[model samples]
Target: MPKPTVKVWMEEGVHSAIFAQQAVVGVFKLPQVTCLCCAIGLPPVHPNVHSTQKGRLLMSSITSTQVVSLSSQAPRPLPFWRRWLRKIEWRLLLLPVIGLLLWQGWVLLAESGYYADFIVPHPDTVWARLQERWADGSLVTHIATTLREALSGLFIASLIATALGYIIARVKIFDYLLTPYLIFLQAIPIIAISPLIIIWFGSGLASKVVIAAMITWFPMMIATIVGIRNVSTNLREMMRANAATHWQIFRHLEIPSAMPELLGGLKIAVTLSVVGAAVGEFVSAREGLGYLVMYGRGISDTPTVVLAVLMLTVVSLVLYSLVAMLETSLLSWRKAGKP
Candidate 1:
């Protein structure tokens, strides 16, 4: 009797190379070779593999020992959950962590420095000052005053910017005529003329609104221009074929298409509007969180300063979240349409 043509082997032990032996001999005999491991319930090679009729025949004839031995050497795969966790977005997750660290570090540094004399009352003493202000109803009034200004500025700026952006996006001539001037306006630092804004509008609500609008307008314009122009030419052509009026096309097609970009711009505008409003308040107002911060700084009341900073931060987060929620509600249709 001839020696057996097939042998079997596994990585963990000194077994014969039976699967390879069987594959080679089967192909030599019948001009075909199929995967022995696959025959014994091992995972198949990827779908992109090329095969001929002869290869199929050889694969079909492989011995059980050869098939079983090859199957035992299958590679280990990572557990699904472990792999997913490894890919979790660290950069996004780390942002809040970094902010917390900075907050703590600022408190520590403030407690130790000679400059602390002017920067604030000691971090330890600041909380007591905040408590006193809160007890007297002063903190709440200041917080409410600043919040109203910031939110109003954000809302009005968002509306005006969206409207103006839509017009510029729709009209090439308007875009050309106004875009450069808008860019020039944005290039100037808001802080440099915040005093001038107070001088012009006289430390009142109107000046804050103007500053917020200026800060909010540029992103809205750029986003709208990009969004409207990004509308599908196919959709435009379909509307034209239906003999839709320009206004009808805009109402039915353009605005919906541009909503995601518009909402993104609005989110940025929301945060910046708060900054603009606060800066305006810092320059002149006796009320608002900016005024609170200014007041706390002047007297070296660190705790009160922290409280004002915290209030501003919370307000910005809340406003930004509201815009994001709006985006989610409005864009649900687009998401549902996708595969």
Candidate 2:
């Protein structure tokens, strides 16, 4: 038998394109065929050579049982747009593609003299600045500083907020006393009091972490209080009726019920933590992206500013994604249990 060449083709209604086995599958004789529409249990039809005589013969020889088996093995392909909608890769690319197009258009207009170049430097200019900073090794240190502050702040806030919120929600008396204090805290602008915080904590990592924690604590506290308090009354009673202890009830019932709100708060907290870290760095910092922003502005370096902003945006996105991923993994049971 001649060693056969095989081409893979899309089948109707499938989310993904699949290739046939390159080697012959005993009686299946996959390698003898030029195309594999029959392998996907479809009639021999191709946009190209998939509809050749060999494909038709392969399809014709299949018994009804084998056809059903093959069909069951692969879904029919969806139309191109449907395929895009069904998968994340293209949809995620869409916005970035549009943004890049708009940016390039602006760059073209600036180059054509419709807009001043100083208004915003070209993407090339920004890329050059990023490369320079990366090569100098400053970019990593700044990002690490900011990330360390933000993550540390978020961690501290989560522990304190969860414990305090639980106490307030369960005890009720502390709800009135502590909730008012948190409201007062949130009401105060972080910038207005940052100087005092910096003075107290010093112009170091301590101040940055304190500022980030202050910015993050209120929302997470609210989320924790709301989530714990919102546990189903029926569930509480049912647990009591079953003589479940407080620990078991909290572990099994309250935590699961409150997960949605807690996660919601965490999403908000993570982003705010980034903002707080930046604000702290803005007010007083030796290094970090915030420092880069200030340094760029001082020197009228648009590319440097933009690059720093983009890195900050990337950091914000990373923190948010981590929370989103955590939410998906933790609360997947709710989705799975849905009818």
Candidate 3:
């Protein structure tokens, strides 16, 4: 009997090799090589592959393995739920762990009198400020105020942008008419024009909402326009052939088709809306995280400033995550369509 020839293939991103045993028939007249493969979500199977025949080589048979679960032994896979949780845990911890270590290092240096507390600010100082603000009920007020402004602006901007984008995309005359004005608006930086907006809108909730809307509208509008334009011509023609009304066509075909681009724009717009709200607050506001940051800066309170900025970041992340969750929920159909 001849010795068995071993063949191995590497799996990408997985630290495992697929090993196959190839037995050659010489004196005894054995048939072919037996290869064991671990199938996804299924039990392993042994396949007999022959390389010699009357004139050609071919696959002979696939059978059950008497033993050897390569998956269980070599590359162990967790249950889907466990894998999901582990992934989330890893992603969530990786950043904060690194950040806390760096921050603590800085804190240690600052506490040792090498760096001034005013400049670096101990992590404890920031935590103390957070607790102080929370105890006084002021933290909730600022957070709520900011959320109201950002969400309001985001909603208003999304509505106007989505509506106008459709018109600009579908109607040539509207596109022509809107182009020059859109160009003018695009040329003017929102920050540069923000003071004017504050002046015009008179420094209230309305002004903040307007500023946020102004800042947020462009990206979503562009996305909607692109999404609408990118809709398949065949789908449009099919709808027309079926005598579908414009409303029906838009609701059924266009909405689903354009969802991906719209969601992408929305994710960006959500973050920008928070910035816009903060910008509005910076220009003029009685209360907000931005106001807290400004107030801290004026008084040289590094801890307060850091705390406010952290809260603002948390707000942005929360809003961004909500949009992401919504996108995932709504876009499952897209995944279903994949072959």
Evaluate all candidate structures by whole-model CA lDDT and list the values in order.
0.72, 0.78, 0.78
Better of 1 and 3 by lDDT: 3
Rank candidates, TM-score, best first: 3, 2, 1
Cα lDDT of model 1 by residue, 5-104, tens digit:
4443334454533323424234333221333333333454222221233434233443333333334546555678987998797788889999889768
**Which TM-score value belongs to model 3?**
0.73
How many clashes in each candidate? Answer: 10, 6, 0
- Per-residue lDDT for 1-339 in model 3, tens only? 333432322233332222233433222222222222333322322244332223222333323222222333355457889978866756766888999898878778768887778888888989999999999999999998888999999999999999999999999999999978986887889888888988999777899899889989999999999999999999999999999998999899999999999999999999999899989888888899988889898899999998999999999999999989999999988788577
RMSD of each: 14.0, 11.9, 12.8
Off by over 4 Å in 3: 1-90, 112-114, 337-339
Model 2 misplaced regions, further than 4 Å? 1-90, 112-118, 337-339
Candidate 1: list runs displaced more than 4 Å: 1-124, 334-339
Q: Specify the poorest-scoring 10-residue window by lDDT in model 1.
A: 44-53
Error of 1 at 86 (Å): 20
- Give the per-residue Cα lDDT of candidate 2 at 160: 95
